[model samples]
Every structure is written in C-alpha cells, then in structure tokens.
Target: MKETAEAYLGRPVSKAVITVPAYFNDAQRQATKDAGRIAGLDVLRIINEPTAASLSYGMDRKEGLVAVFDLGGGTFDISILEISGGVFEVKATNGDTFLGGEDFDNALLQHLVDEFRKEQGIDLTKDRLALQRLREAAEKAKCELSSTSQTDINIPFITADATGAKHLSFTLTRSKFETLVNPLVERTRQPCKDCLRDAGISAKDITEVILVGGMSRMPKVQEVVQEIFGRQPSKNVNPDECVAMGAAIQGGVLRGDVKDILLLDVTPLSLGIETLGGVFTRLINRNTTIPTKKSQVFSTAADGQTQVGIKVLQGEREMAADNKLLGQFDLVGIPPAPRGMPQIEVTFDIDANGIVHVGAKDKATNKEQAITIQSSGGLSDSDIDRMVREAEQYAGKDKERKALIEARNDADTTMYSVERSLNEHKEKLPSDVVEAVQAAIADLKGSLEKDNLEEIREKISAASRHHSRLARPCLGKRAAAARLLLGGRPEEPRKRSMRRRSRGTYAESNSQVVVRVRCIKLFGPWEGQDHEIGVRHSCCLIAVTGIQSCTAVSIWAGVLH
Candidate 1:
C-alpha cells in the first residue's frame, strides 16, 4: 500500500487509516496495525469496513437514517447509522466475517466439478491447477450472470481423463445461479433484522439503504435488500470503490483536509474482566461508542484477599475462559482485608485509536497500576522489525510472482466466461460479435503464455468488456419482458401517508385547520392499537406505522404543520 501510494503520488507516503472487518477482534485489529508498520506506513487508526462505506455515502448527503449492507469477497457486514449535521453515529453493526462472494463461487464450482466427474469419470478436484481453473471459471460466471440472465462456463483442457484430456463446459442461467446463492444471501437477513432490533428501529424506519462491496453489484442481492427493507438500495456510489473512497475521506479528516465531519465508531466486542467464580463481568459493552470510558468495582472473593488479579477479556461469552483474554495485570501491596472488604476499581479506557488502557486502584492505600495494553496476541516490536526487513529485501521478487499469478488468474476467468458466451449464443449472435469475441479469447489465451503481466491483464479486461457488451442485449430483453409482465412499469416508491381529522366531543368542525400526529405499536402486548386522546380541535394526524411505540400529539403537533 505504501509503495502503491508513493508511486501514484510521485512522493514518499508514510501515513494511512486502514479499514477492517466489523467483526474483527482486538487481536485482528492489532495485527492490522502491525502490518501497516511493517509496510513502512504509520497507522493512524483502524476503522470498520461498513462504517467506512457509510462515510463514503454520507459525504455528499446529510440527515438520513442509513443501513449499510456490505458483502465483500469473503465477509458480510451490516451497519445502521443515523446521519445528521455531518455526524455519522452508528447505532448497530452485525455480520458474518466468513460469508461473502467466495462462498457463491465455491458453491457453483462444487456443482460444476460434480457434473464433470459424473459425466467423464474425472475428479477435477484432485488436481490443484484444475480446481483453480474451475474456481476462476465459476467466479466469472457468477459475475456475468449478475448482468445477464444466462452465461456459459467453459474451460479448455481443465483436466485429464482416461481417454486423453477433457474440457468442462456448462450453461448457467441467472435463475439457477440465484437458486445456488439465494440460501447464502438469505443468511444476511437475520443479521439485518438483528441490527434493526439493536438500533431500536424498524426496517421501515430506515430512510436510505446503501449497498457496498464487489458482490453488491449482483441483481439478486439488490432484490433481497429491497424485499427486506421495503425500499430500493441506493445506487449512487460504486460498490467496489466506495470503501477506498471512504478511507481516503477519513484520511482527509485526520489531516484536517476535510472539515465539519465527525465519525463515531463502536467496539465490535465486549470488554470485560474475570470476576467471582470465573464469570465475565463487562465494563464496556460491544457496540458502545468509543473514545469512551467505563469502570466497574469489585471485591475479593477469597478470605484475607490482599491482591486482586485484573485479567482483561473481549467477547460476548458468559464464561471468562470461553472468551479471548486480551491482557492481564495484578494489583498488589494492598492492606490485607477479609473477603468482600477491599474496594478495587478497574477502569477500561479505549481511546480514539481503539487501543485499550487499563488502570487498577486500591482506594484504601491509594496504590495504582496503569498499563497500556498493546495486544494479548500481537507480535512484539522485534518481531515486527524482523518481518519488515525481510519483506523489504524480498519485495521485488514477491511482486513479480504475485503479479504473474494475478494475471494468469484473471486471464483464465475472462477466457472461460467469453468462451461460454460464444458457445451458448453463437447461433443468435451477430457475425461481427462472434468474430470479435473469439479473437479476444484467443488473444487472451496467447497472452497467458507470455511473461508480460500487464499485457495479460489488458487482454483479460478487453475480453471481459467484449463479453459484457455482447451479452447486454440478452439481459436487456429479459429485463424488459419481466417489466412487461409486471404491468409495463417499474415498482413505485412508497409514500408516507398523513390524514386530517376534526377533534371534538360532538364532532363539530370549525373554520380553522389543525394538525396532530399519532404512532401505534404493531406487535407485542400493545399490538394493533392506537393511543386514545381527548379531542379538542380540528386536527391532522400523520400515523406512522413502523415506529416502536404508540403516542399522541404533544408539543410535536405544532411542529408538524
């Protein structure tokens, strides 16, 4: 990252604000900071991926409740935030760090491999290169099907059979692909509901929904989001570039290049310590706003307990042993006292950088121990220096190897998708389209054998562009037919309904107009009910259905007008 920045700016770069998964624990976050230092970059702060994506979206807009749904290559994060006055305050965040687009690709890959093995009696999974090729093909097919209703997956000489060599070829339609990944996408629903519950808001209350990450481009993902939120997800920002744009925005905030923006993030997990019977007692709860402090008092459990053991932990589990131990310290030299007599205060302070500082004080003796905790599972300074020197030494060679692998991987994916398109649409495609696609495929294949990674990348991108262009008409036709089936129009936006009613004991109306607003509880003990109020004048009431509690007009009545 440092080298990339330096090369791009034509100057030395030394500082960065990195983004990580919302579910990353303290160890993972610390590891990220250490990695930044290893790359010769000063880590300013660690931010959450969903939060960063939200920052990107809220940069140009203000005053909306947004739910950020980010589905990346291997992780899914959902964050609910209230944006107002240039402040992005996260209400709740939930995610599955292991769930992402890779899972979709793997599901398709497994299906293809099974089909190939059954027909040709060849298990492609037994060969690493064959499996890798199939994975590339599967990912490309997935991406292509996002824009088109149907796509082909074709890999030449993917594996060897008893006869000689065999190729894997198959047709994947959008419907079938949706079936394959729908279950995986469905996995995000629970988290969304959970986030709403945590935020004390309903899905209907969210004013805007933002989708980010590469996988967010999938039409199926958009549909699922709409089904859950009852609103269309915002397409104003690019899913792939939004996070980086947000990080850059955050960097600007740090350098004072940007103004009037405030970011408030939360800790992903609870921070606590062990108490009596090894029970975990939390001081700072998960999702609590940071640059915050919380302290809990404790008494020694054993008789004549003089010293208290402070073991810092992180996680939501009840048992201290089941959670991750962040760090530990001891408070000693206390006046000997019976059980439950000594007053020991343990305070946890998490700063802006998200690093923790623990302080333990004995009120009787006024003795204190303050420790700046780096990490319980982080590498030491010497280890970081060693790794950095080693990386610097081997940087050139590693870059070449990485670039070559990436180039080959991209070329393989593009060629497979292009070949699939050519095979399935050959009869219907224009002659020029057919010739151009075939030539592009051949050129990409030829570039794979050369040592030039840049050339390989260019050929792969060119082939992908041609394939998308040829497939666009088919996708358009499918979309048009669906629109026609749905009354030749797109879904209309829902409007909030408001009504006016005259308020009187005998229902008498006057020449004056008045407004009133009421809300009702939709579920639970007070379900299907409205608040009763004394009628006094002609009024208008805007009854919002999705908010949590039922309420009558108060001082808010005058403001509604």
Candidate 2:
C-alpha cells in the first residue's frame, strides 16, 4: 500500500495514518503500526475504519448522530458517532472480527461442495485446486447476486473422480443466496441494536446512516441496515475505498492541510480486573471515549494480606472466569495491614490507540507499578522494542522531509493570505506598505520553488511581518469602528437611578430598589455619556429617567445600603 501510494503520487510518502477495525484490540493495532514501519512509513495514527468511512462521506460537517455499518471481507464493525462542529466522535462500536463476506462465500461453498459430492459421488473439498475454484466461483456468484436476481456458478475440471475430471454447474438465485447467508447478515442486527443502546440513542434519532466495506454492497446487508435503522442506508461513499479516503483525510489533517476536524474514538470493550469472590470489577466501560483514565481503590480481602493479585480482564461478563484475561500483576510490600486497610489504587489508562495501561499504587508507601496489556496477545517487550528501534532508524530523514513539506505549506498559506489582504485593503494602506507586502509575497513565492526549507521559512516570516505591517491601518479602522459601536469611551462618574417594578397589578407595582448601581452606559453611542450611580433609598424604588434609549448597559450592580 505504501509503495502504491508513493508511486501514484510520484513522491516519497514517509508518514501515514492507517485505519483499522474499530473493535481492534491493542495487539492488532500495534501489528498494523509495525507493518507500516516495516514498509518505511511512519504510522502517525491508527484510526477506526468506520470513523474513516464517516470522514469519506464528510459527515463531520453535518450535525446529529450517525451510524457506520462496515462489513468487510473477513470482519464486521458497526460504529455509532455523534457529529458536530467538524468533530466525529464514536459513541459506541461493536463487531465480530471473524464474521464477514468471506463467511457468506464459505456458506455457499459448503452447499455447492455437498451437492457436488452427492451428485457425482466425488468429495472435492479435500482437493486444494478444486476447492479454490469452487471458492472463487462462489465469491463471484455472491457479488453477482447482489445486482441481479440470479447467477450461474459453473466450473469445469473442478475435481477428478476415480475415472477423470468432472464439471460442476449450479444455478444460484438471489433468494436462495439470501436464504443461505441470511443468518450471517442477521448476525449484525443485535450488534447494531446494542451499539445504539450503548450510545443512548434510538434508531429514529440517527440523522444519517453510512454503509462501508465491500461486503456492505451486498443487497441483503443493505436491506438489513435499512430495516434496522428504519431508513435507507447512505451510499454516499464508495464501499471499498471510503476507509482509505478517510485515512487520507486524516493524513491531510495531520499535515495542516485540513483544519477544524476532530476524531474521538471509543474503547470497544470493558476493561477491568478480577476482584474478590472471583467477580469482575469494571473501571472503563465498553464504548467509553478513548484516552480516558479511571482509578478505583481496592483492598485486600484477607487479614494481614501483604500481596494482592490484579488480573486484568476484558469483556462484558460479570465473572472474571468468563471474560478474556488480558494480563495480571501483583502488588507486594503492603505493610501487613488488615483487609481493606491498605488502599491500593488500581488505575486503568487507555490511550488513544485503545491500548490499556494498568497501574497499581500503594497509598501508604507511594510505590507504583504499571503494565501495558498486550491486546493482540503474548507479544513480549523485546519484540516491541525492536520494532521501535527499526522505526527510529528512519526518523532523521523523515523528520527533515516532513519539515520541508511543512515549510512549503506554511509559505503557501502565508502568501495566499497576504495576497488576499493586500487586495482587500490596498486602498486603506500607504502605497509603500502595499509595495513592501507585494515584494515580500514575491520573495516567498520564489523561495517556494527552491529546495531550501530554511529559505522558505525565512521568507514566510518576513512576508507575514510585512503583511501585518500593511494590515495595521485597516485593523485600526476596524478597532475604531468597534469602539463607536460599543461606547466611544468612559467619562467622569455621575449619579443615576432606575425604577423597580413588581407584579403587573398597580397595587404591587411599587417595589424597593435593594441593589446599587456603580456605572451605566445607555443604549447607543456614549462618547461622554458615562454615569456612576450611588446607592438608592433602601425600601423605595428609584427610577432613572432621561437618556435616549430605554435599555441600560450596567457595568456594575451591587447591594444597596
């Protein structure tokens, strides 16, 4: 992928933001980063694939809640997001990593194999070539069924019987295909409902629903999404490339080419530890926003227990034994206190990558221990360190390249802004100031054509200074106008009074002025209209009359004497 991107762009692509399954754990995420590094790309971030899909559809520019249903070749992911102010925040995400389009193909393949065996008395599943042929045919048929009512699955020389090679031909209809894979498509329904429930939103509340991944093109999958969400799924983004597009958008954001876009992802599962009585105690619940930290105080269950075992678990189960064990560590040197006396603060810190860091602190001793749970499985520290070192080896060159790109981007943006300002305010500025601004812009533009980053930066700075100098007069005019709109300026203090009123009835219209006024500005211009009012009569209303407008801009109101 890195090579292809670089080749297409005709440039060296050193940094990238890769998208992964929203439900991917730490190990899977790390493995992706590692792969990027191996390909000579600095992995800037690991974003959720569904979130990327949302970006592809430009959903961040819209408001309200959205759902991204992604069913890829080998996995399924559903993400519920709240979009506002160019921010896409994943409220909840859920998926089965092993379930996807491949499953449907497998289902069809099983049926075909069974029928072939029954018809020709030849079990071809054991033959690699025959099985591969059948699998490919099944995949093609599945895709064709999505668009048409029926398709033919035919393969000659599918396998050899005791006599010779045999041919397998079958007519697969859309209804039959749906029937075979309906269970697999239906599997996503509960997860969609669960994700919505976790997000505290109802199906009707979703303003837009996006479908991504190649499998989402399946008619059955689209029907399921529409049925569950009560609206036709949005096909605004290409099913196969939306995730990549989103990743590219993220890369642009990192490079400052894109602005005001934010992504807030969530942890896919609950993370906690085993407590006393073999129960699971959750610290960070599933679907909670990422880069979150929570600490809970735990105590020894037995008297004089100096050591405590902390077994970290992940899942939605109530019992520790039922959940997946992530990792475990022990806390020692507790000073032999009674059960529940020593305060052991177990802290769960899940970073933006959704990787968890578990820490235990003995309050009395101020000693702490921390462990990073490997979500992918038993990857040792050495393996990670090696990958880190390998990635760092390219850091120097990549850093220089990144600096050059940034300098160029900065130069281009500054030149554009300066040019625009020069055009907009040239009439208000001195002739020499405009000339200097134009000269600076020309110099900056010239520097952009060169390979010298330092020269480009210097020109950018000089151009910005010139632009600021030219903008001073226009800025001063704007400031003076703003002052005229507010109040001209403050003047000497003078006394004033404002009447108090109660209920609408005349009997209760008279009320005490219990508050004091310090200074007030009446509506409209106040070049010399400032006034300072002293405390009014305690129980009698004092109405401040006169002034041009009815509204008063009180700078200070306090208790009266």
Top candidate when judged by TM-score against the true structure: 1
- TM-score for every candidate vs. truth? 0.70, 0.67
lDDT of each: 0.77, 0.76
What's the lDDT for residue 132 in model 2?
72
| Inter-residue clash pairs, candidate 1 | 515-540, 516-540, 516-541
Residue-level lDDT of model 2, residues 1-561, one tens digit each, is 876988999998888888888887666776777677666677888899999998878744777788999999888999998888998888899998889888999999999999998999888777655687788889999889879999877664455434543667788899998998889998999989999888888999998899888889888888889999999998678989889999889888889999999888898989899998899999999988888999999888999998888899988999999988888898888888778899999999987767788999999998788898865465565776676676679778788989999999778767755665466556778888988888999999898889898899899889977864653454443443333444444332323344442311112213322332322333222212223222222112222222111111122222121
Please identify model 1 stretches exceeding 4 Å from their true place.
Answer: 370-376, 389-561
| Candidate 2 runs further than 4 Å off | 385-561
Candidate 2 similarity to native, TM-score? 0.67
Candidate 2, lDDT over the whole model? 0.76
lDDT of 2 at 97: 87
